[model samples]
Target: MIVAIIDYGSGNLRSAAKAFERAVAEADVDARIRVTADADEVAAADRIVLPGVGAFADCRRGLLGLPGMSDALASAVLEKGRPFLGICVGMQLMATVGREHGDHPGLGWIEGEVALLPAAGEGLKIPHMGWNDLRIAAPAHPVLAGLASGAHAYFVHSYAFVPADPRRVLATVDYGAPVSAVIGRDNLVGTQFHPEKSQATGLRLITNFLGWRP
Candidate 1:
C-alpha cells in the first residue's frame, strides 16, 4: 500500500515523513511513504496524511494554491473512503472556517469552526505548546486502541476546533480549558498536536493510523 504524506510547503515534512517511516517499520505495515505535492499521486494512494503549521489563513492558502489538491483529497477521502489523518493546522482545516487573523474557509469535512483558545486561567499560555495529556473521548475508536490513559501528545497552537456536533470529538486536552485535541468521523481523523514530536505516544498513534482500516 502507498501512504502519501502531502507536501504543501508548510509543515515539517521531513520530520513527519521520518515518523511515518519509523511507524511503518516498527509496525511491520506493508506500505510505502511518499512526501508529495502531486495531487494525482495523493488520489492514487491507499492512505493519506496532511500535515501543516503556521497561521490558519496562510496554511489554507498554501493548500488551496495547489491546482487539484483539494479535489484529490475530496475524491480520495470523502468519496472513496480512504483513511485520512490531518495534523496540527491540517487538522484545523477540517473545520468549516478558521478565525485566526481573519476568517477563512476550511475543508469543512468535520462541521466545525476553528477559534482562539480561551485564556482558561491565570498562567495558561495562548499557544498551547509542549506535552499535554490526551483524554480519549472515543475510546472505542480503532485508531485509539492501545493508547494508555493520560497519553501525552505534543501541542503548539493558539486555536482549537469547536465542532458543530460534539460527537465528532475523539479526544481533548486541558490547557486551562478542555480543547479539542482529536476529531474524526468515518474515514477521517485529525489531531491538534504534533504527533511526530510526541515521542513514544506519537509513534503509537502513527502506528495505529498506518494500520487503521477506517
Candidate 2:
C-alpha cells in the first residue's frame, strides 16, 4: 500500500511523516509513505493525507499554486474513491468555505464552513491548545476504532469546522463550547487535532486509518 502525505508548503511535514512512518511500522503494514508536491505522486497514491498549518487563504493558495495539483487530487481522492485524511488546516480546507482572512473557497469535500472558535466565556482561549477529551459521536466509525468517548487528543487551532449536517461529526471536544474534533463521510475523514502530536491516541487513529477500507 502507498500513503501519500501531500507537501503543499504548509504544515509540519516532518512530524506528520514520522508519525505515519511509525504507525505503519507498528501496525505491521507494508505501506510505502511519501511526502511530495508532485501531482503524479498524489494521483498514484492509494491513500492520501493532506496536512496544513497557517491561515486558510494562504494554505488554499499554496495548494492551488501548483499546476494540476488540484485536479490530480480531485481525480485520486474524489473520483477514484481513495481513502483520504486531512489534518488541522488541511482538514479545514475540506470544507465548502472558510471565513478566515475573509471568505475563501475550499475543496468542498465536506459540507461545512471553517470559522473561528466562538468565545466560550471569559478565560477561554482562541487557539484551543493542549490536550482535550474527545466525545465520540460515532463510536462505530472505523477511523475511531479503539478510541473511547473520553480519550484525550492534543489540539492547537483557533478555527473549527462546523458541518452543515450534524451526522458528519464523528467526535467533538469541549472548550468554551462543543468543538468538532473529527468529521467524516464515505471514504474521507478529518481531524481538528494533530494526530501526529496526539501520541498513543493519535497513533491508534493512524493505524486504524491505514487499515480502513473506506
* Candidate with maximal lDDT: 2
Local accuracy of candidate 2 as per-residue lDDT tens digits, 1-214: 9999999899999999999999988889999989999999999999999999999999999998988899999999989999999999999999999999799999999999999887535468778889999999999999999999889899999899999999999999998888899999999999999999999999999999999997
- Model 2 pairs in collision: none
Write candidate 1's Cα lDDT for 5-87 as tens digits: 98988999999999999998988899999999999999999999999899999998898888899899989999999999999
RMSD of 1: 1.1
Alpha-carbon lDDT of model 2: 0.93
Cα displacement (angstroms), candidate 2, residue 173, comes to 0.3
After TM-score superposition, the amount by which residue 83's alpha carbon in candidate 2 deviates from its true location, in angstroms, is 0.4
Question: Would you estimate the TM-scores of all the predictions?
Answer: 0.97, 0.98
